[model samples]
Target: MPLLSADQLTIQRGDRALLRDFDLRLAAGELLHLRGANGIGKTSLLETLAGLRRPAAGQCRLADEAAGLHWLGHRNGLNLQLSAIDNLRFWCGINGASPAGIDAALAGVELPARARRRACRSLSAGQKRRSALARLLLQPRPVWLLDEPLDGLDAGGLALFAALTQAHLAQGGAVLMTSHQTLPAPLAARELIL
Candidate 1:
């Protein structure tokens, strides 16, 4: 069975159809990239796959079912009032993941020294984005549903993110992401334009 699968998926928002007859499968270590024009429901699709939103039709099956997935939305899911470390802790707690290796996770995103610093209210846009990504490292999940993760990242940050993705895949994790920016090297991702 696929690590994650959505079969004949359909979703609607009020009178509008967001997705129709959509299907997807992610095997272990595979990465699927989703692309579409603005307002085409790419974010909505990811949300449904992550179980944050319900689909009007179709079935979603999590092969491991017990090991949950992580959903990173366009909003970055950061708290402006909390420190970067605190933010990581909060997401870990929510996901039932312990804070072990949290510092290393922050370091992986190049935020080691500033891990204890206040959040995005004082951080530059790129820093805020990196802090948000740090959650992926600290949290333990088998699948990732990332929406526009590369949005505000600089060239250097993008390079770091590419490496991070490679590492995640190497660990046999599955990823589904939507990005306007082409993913950096070592991803070997397949595209599905909504």
Candidate 2:
């Protein structure tokens, strides 16, 4: 059975149709890459799948009993005042996941040393993005809805993120990420352009 499916999905923002008759089906361990020009409703689709935005018409179904989802948007979604670890802990706790093991999560993104320190209000754009990604990992969701997840990462960071995503998929997790950069060579993914 498909892990998740969106049937005839439609979304609108103030009478502007962001997406119309959009359909998607995700199987276990599947990754669907969304590629589209700006203003094409990729983010709107992700938001709808994540249950953060209601679709104007359509139905989304989660097949698995233990199903859950995570969403990362264009914004880093981080608090400037909290340290990376603290921010991760907050998200994990709210999501019913482990809150105290964020050090390892930060390490996965090559930000271990920055874990204890407050999110640099003065940090570079890349560091802030990494901090937000660290929080994403701390939550244990089976589905990931990522919008431009590769933005701001350097070469090595990009490789690390790809590897992490691959590992996630290998473990029966599904990913729906939007990216301008090409995916890693071996993930067996498909891109759907809106």
Candidate 3:
């Protein structure tokens, strides 16, 4: 079964119709990349799929509601006041994951022990982005909706994301994301241009 299916999806902002008459299906073990110019509603499209917004038209269906989803938007979605470890702890608690994996998740994103203890506000932009990405490893959800997921990453961060995403796909999880950059080599994706 498809992880997510959207039929004739329409996206709008205020009175402006950004995109219309779209269709998409994301299958398990697959990745779909959304390509478009800025300000063309890629974020809105992702929000609609993640169930954060109602589509202007059409509907979206997820194969398993209990399986849940992971959403990474343009913002890192970190609490600047909290340390990386603490932020992940809170996410783990909310997502029904064990806090024990926090250290491993941090390490997966290449965050060092010292930086993990520092406040997110004190970390560099790339570190903050990595901290946010670590949440994806906190729990196993069947679907991930990411918008501009690699916006601030350096080469190492990019490589790290590729490895993490590849693993997720290997486990039959699906991803629908928007990125201007090409997906790392060896990670195949079907693209939809808006």
Candidate 4:
């Protein structure tokens, strides 16, 4: 069965139909990329899939429990006052996941041990982005909904994210993300243009 399915989904903003009768299905171990020009409802579609906003018409369904979905928006969702480790701990607690892998997750995102101790407010843009990406490692979910996940990432960060995404798919997880750039080699992804 598909992990997620949107049937004849319609979304509108102030009578302007961003998307009409759109449909999508994502199965386990699959990656779907949302591609389109700006103001074409890519973000809105992702937000609806993430359940952040209700669709104007139709509905999105998840085959599994809601807890299996992880939504990562354009914002990193990190607390600037907290250190990277602390941020991971807080998120893990909220997700009902253990914080024991905090250090390993930080390393996975290419965040050094020293930087992990520094407050998020002091980290650079790329570092902050990596810190946010570390949450994926700390809390493993079956479905990931990411919007502009590569926005602040550098070359190396992009590679790391690709590797993480590939590993997630290999583990039978699914990913739905929006990105302008093409995905890196070895990660087969389907494109959905809005």
> Which model scores highest in lDDT?
3
Q: For this target, which candidate reaches the highest TM-score against the unseen true structure? A: 3
Q: Residues 61-85, candidate 4, lDDT per residue (tens digit)?
A: 9998755788888888999999999
lDDT of each: 0.85, 0.80, 0.91, 0.89
Q: Estimate candidate 4's alpha-carbon lDDT, on a 0 to 1 scale.
A: 0.89
Residue 32's lDDT within candidate 4 is 95
Q: Could you tell me how far off, in angstroms, the CA of residue 96 lies in candidate 3 after the best superposition? A: 2.7
Alpha-carbon TM-score of each model against the true structure:
0.94, 0.91, 0.95, 0.94
Q: Specify the poorest-scoring 10-residue window by lDDT in model 1.
A: 111-120
Query: Backbone clashes per model, in order?
Result: 0, 0, 0, 0
- Candidate 3's clash total is 0
Cα lDDT tens digits, model 2, 1-194, are: 77789999999988999988988898878889899898888888888888889999998887764757778898888877887777777778777888666787787788748445866575666777788878657766778889988788887778777788888888888888898788766666887987
Cα TM-score of candidate 4: 0.94
94-146 per-residue lDDT for model 1 (tens digits): 87788887788778899648545765678877888888888887766789989
Superior by TM-score: candidate 1 or candidate 2: 1
After superposition, the stretches of candidate 2 with alpha carbons farther than 4 Å from their true spots are: 114-116
TM-score of 2: 0.91
Candidate 3 per-residue lDDT, tens place, 72-131, comes to 988988999999999999888877899999999999899978999999999988999999
Please give the distance, in angstroms, between residue 131's alpha carbon in candidate 4 and its true position after superposition: 0.8
